[model samples]
Target: MLRYGDYTLSDDLITKITAVARHDDLVPSFVICQLCHETALGQHPNSISAREDNNWSGMTWGYDDLDPKTRKSGVQVTPGRKRPAVEGGYYIHYATVEDFLKDYGYLLRNGGFYKTSGAKTLWDHARGLFRLGGAQYDYAGDGSNSEKVFNSYYTSMKTIHDALNADGSLDRIDKGESSNMAGLQSLFSIARQYLNEQMYGSGHRRIVDTYNGQNPLPVGYKLKIDDDWCAAFVTAMSILSGNYALTGGECGVERFVRDVFQKKGIWLGKVRPQAGDIIIFDWDANYWADHIGYVESVSGDTVYTIEGNSGSPSAVRRQSYTWNMWQIKGYDRPKWDYASPAPLSVGGKSIDAIAQEVLTGARSYRIKKNTSSLFE
Candidate 1:
């Protein structure tokens, strides 16, 4: 089975699709979703478009009588006549898979579809494609009931995206051009200094003192002078190391650690090991993660870690463990948002209000084309 996020393509079609998309400058996720909707990833074994014409995107056959250069035709099949057949009418075809993608990309980019709405996310782009395809779906305002089906599509794609990301498949799929774990490198750099700092005295005092000076106390709890400083040490290091986002605003290690993984949708045993991941330990293998550390590195059969509470003095120590170590419960990889999403709130105005302001700024499309409306 081939994976594209969390969903499995169960075939090698995604490999070719990704290649074509990357080379053609089309968003891979959007194209994949369209293919999923159009042809079910070519899982319809007896599909006429898949078997006869190698077309899986349902591009329609066209002939321009006025201009010979505009003529484009495909091997047509009637609705409901064959497996994976179009329900409404005859559909288009292509000679090869590459040709299908090339034509589809060209049409999507040059046609009024992509030109109309400057969509940023894959879901929004899918909305545009749905509109262009005359699909019965609305893209306005988080999509109402008519467009609620779009949510399923978006959820599936996001599942796939997150799965692929957790499994580190995007790096391999993108030919190592993008590494999801690249953001963790800086965290390791920041944590490198305290690799072997031994805590004197009660050890908890130093940790609490260090934490208070750097940032304000977290919402609920005030730091006790002699509390177990392991969690506090981890939290302080995180804030100092520029990974404040994953801290989860919790003073406790277990709570924040769980929060990081849950919020990121990455669970233990679901993701591959990468440096700078937060490693929590279950000392007695009782399913309770009590101790936490930063993943230093992973070798072939062993994992190296830099932990805060190692000895009685409570000094940071570098430790190594084999994969079968019972104390190792699991690891949580920090979710780093490299690209911020579009601002939903702008200058204290709600997104709806801002959208209205935007709509008021631009004139509505009124031009006519081929007895239909020409979108601006």
Candidate 2:
């Protein structure tokens, strides 16, 4: 709904970009902002890709992994008008704008560096622009996580993300149709659909892990990927259910609590939780929140939950806890409105939930710094 009414980039092209990027599970707005940055809103002199090839985002055709995916070898071209490919070939020439977009989406989605560069979330990508600048080009070759570099690229994207989503509205946020329980029921239902789900090294959860900029268990490893991904699952549920605006996503629980729940004023401390509240627990009663899960329902003194990274083999499963168990730290509730439940999966892809990013040590350096405010 962003009125790109002020830009010269045609609505058709922008629309195509959105459709293609989203089709591949890539965030389209970030892709659009990157295109604007690289091609000067598709008006740069070096953007012959934009003019002739319809490669509006400066995609090069040199990587071997990406080569086999495309039908053609690509057009021989140079970085600038006067320059030429060192030998005779290597810049991608699209047969159609569709071809270019398909390859572009494939590159970003499967590309080794984009996710690590923080491509999962728009602001996330700003952190590792050195690797992300141009995996082949290494645009920020100095390898500095400098504010100046971020200011240049991310600031431009910020200018475009409706002033950085100022006022905190997200794209898919739905207003309540009935009561809070209705939306909470929908959230629980969406999560319930994925119960007994296996934790695999490949699939939607693994992909979303990279998108979140968290290193996920690699495929083909000897181990069965038993890493703790509870928080990732919760975060993914938030996104898949269109509740991300209410339930902010983060890889670490400490960060989720301190940065999101607490910062957003959603951290309801030590209060009895209802269904749909995010519950935090402390196994040791040492004051740091160690585990997180969603409240399915509260029956008497027991709280049912759908937690990722639960049980013996480690998978998405349902469990119960005493409502006031010492391990039960507190709850953070999202303000929900009524709506129908979203499908647990999309296009055979989950897009966001069910991966438990490892909890290396919640009581480590991070929580040590943020513990003062919780009990206060």
Candidate 3:
């Protein structure tokens, strides 16, 4: 009998993939399975190019090319371009796995294919690949008639998932050694705080307070200063958690983003959005960004955000407001150099309790330190 973790390559790959998925608040097993099917566990490096260019299923290039009328000269042909090129057969290439992962995460985050009723979870994402009764699989290369490819991918993913017990259950081979419960909880809690700050005011601390109260500012509030809510939230969480800072700031949002981006193997400079990533936006139309938000969720054509000072009188608030409007001007997700556990106060009271007392419905308690500076 083959044990679930028998395949070393698949197991290790799945572990890495799961870490990525979990960090992105996605289902680790589902993403691993899908990628396994798509990349054959990196056996087909060309598949990364395929995904980049044609969005093909783990394969490079498409079967057909564009006609000459549609073709334009001066175009770059990178990689995975089929021979006897058609009019618009352009080659694409990904320089590294980091590049591929960023693009892949962007696709999954913004891909319309995953928004349909049939594709809510990572499991749905996998099954949706075999839509139309399995007669046709989306993204699968043409002339590849083997259903075994998908089966192998699915089986391999299941094997990995069973080994890791990635569903937050106890089926794992190592008894959940790989699960980062504390890390995940911290991330989630920080994300919630980020949302609250964006919609209401950073001054507001408690989630319950923001949920119950009216807008923090007056009805006709207009913000004078623009603070990068996303960056500020990240910094606040990092400081509270006692993480190391590579750069100086009031807290350390930029440093945190930089560290996390580097640590997670994600490219730091980019315009694409990833789920749970702190997205910075330049509201003043200047090249230098002045605003930021956490990607609460991504649905086709709609991105749910948790930002600070989005409302009038741009200030920190407790509740998070959802905004579908606004163009994505810029983004940054930095890697962390080191993550130290947040120190426990001698009193031993939970952070949540402190935040509640500071933030909850006690509008008087929530104080606005400085309007122009994110550090405040």
Residues 60-97, model 1: lDDT tens digits? 44432212222232222223223233344444455456
Each model's lDDT comes to 0.52, 0.56, 0.40
Cα lDDT tens digits for candidate 3, 158-183: 66555544454323311213223343
lDDT of 2 by residue, 34-93 (tens): 666666555677677576766666565555443334333233333322215564444555
> Which candidate leads the pack in lDDT?
2
RMSD (CA, angstroms), candidate 2: 18.9
- Residue 101 in candidate 2 has what lDDT? 63
Candidate ranking under TM-score, highest first, comes to 3, 1, 2
Task: Kindly report which residue stretches of model 3 are placed more than 4 angstroms away from their true locations once superposed.
Answer: 1-29, 37-40, 43-94, 101-166, 169-237, 244-279, 284-288, 293-315, 327-339, 346-376
User: 2 or 3, which is superior by lDDT?
Assistant: 2
The candidate with the higher lDDT, 1 or 3, is 1
The local distance difference test score of model 2 is: 0.56
Clashing pairs in 1: 5-160, 5-161, 5-164, 6-159, 6-160
Question: TM-scores of the models, in the given order?
Answer: 0.44, 0.40, 0.44
